[model samples]
Target: MNDSKPTPSFWKTPFGIGATVIAVAASIYLYIEHRNHLLALLPYAFLAACPLMHLFMHRGHGHGAHGHGQRDDTPKRD
Candidate 1:
């Protein structure tokens, strides 16, 4: 029986490294060229995040199931 190690993922290869370098360089160039435009949108981005935060933050709370005058089934501790 022959045993061999698995090949590395694409991101771990030389070509992937080159591509990543290029992508990061491009991103830096773009940000430098449009810093003002991007910064101007920061407030709008924060506003958009508010609704998303509310939606995700309440997901585990089981909202509307135990609140609003409804009696909770959990036992009260002394």
Candidate 2:
């Protein structure tokens, strides 16, 4: 039986060239269409989101790798 995983193709990969191109294009379009709105909210939005983003990220990753050691919280038997 084959246990190996198949590698992702160009578009299938996360944050690949295609994704980057799409994101850049969208950003450019938004900037052109809503330059004033973007300018007004960009800084405040970033500042407002910074603390919440940090809390969210830290909460999500607080446990160490390997899911904080064990699936069951109770002590394990030998």
Candidate 3:
């Protein structure tokens, strides 16, 4: 007699199923009620702050890929 149970796929898992249900419900509610607010602010907010956000995003990496102290071979100038 077979005793093993079948394995569950992604949405069959508890967290996955719960998250899917929540997302669908939230989307339906938003579309039925708050869609105008979501639509109105999203594009303007994205456009206004995107460049400043990008500029700051590039920082904190600090000098080159090999750290600030180490130098790799690149043919020394003579």
Candidate 4:
């Protein structure tokens, strides 16, 4: 049987390194130039994250047949 590994993706190649360097430089430039505008929106970004956090974090709460303040009396398995 042949034993060959798959090729690495573009993000793992030299081009990806160049792209990452450009992206970091651009981000640093933008952050420096738009410091005031970005900082001003920080509070709104947090306020918008509240509902998103609740929606994502409350998945296993079982909001359907299992009512609130009730415990699951089922036996535990090893």
* For every candidate, C-alpha RMSD to the true structure in Å: 7.8, 7.2, 9.6, 5.5
Off by over 4 Å in 1: 1-29, 74-78
Candidates in order, TM-scores: namely 0.51, 0.49, 0.43, 0.49
Cα lDDT, all candidates: 0.89, 0.81, 0.83, 0.87
Decreasing lDDT order of the candidates: 1, 4, 3, 2
TM-score of 1: 0.51
Best by TM-score: 1
Ten contiguous residues minimizing lDDT sum, candidate 1? 59-68
- Candidate 3 clashing pairs, residues 3+ apart or interchain: none
lDDT of 2 by residue, 1-78 (tens): 999989888776776977889999999999999999999998999999999998888875435645644675565454
Using TM-score as the measure, name the better of candidate 1 and candidate 4. 1
Those runs of model 2 whose alpha carbons end farther than 4 Å from true positions after fitting are: 1-15, 60-78
Q: Give the per-residue lDDT of model 1 (tens digit) for 5-78.
A: 89999899999999999999998997999999989998999999999999999986768766688878887464
Q: Tell me the lDDT of model 2 at 68.
A: 46
Looking at model 3, how many pairs of residues clash? 0
The numbered model that scores best in lDDT is 1
> Tens digit of lDDT per residue, candidate 3, span 2-31?
999898898899999999999999989997
TM-score of predicted model 2?
Answer: 0.49
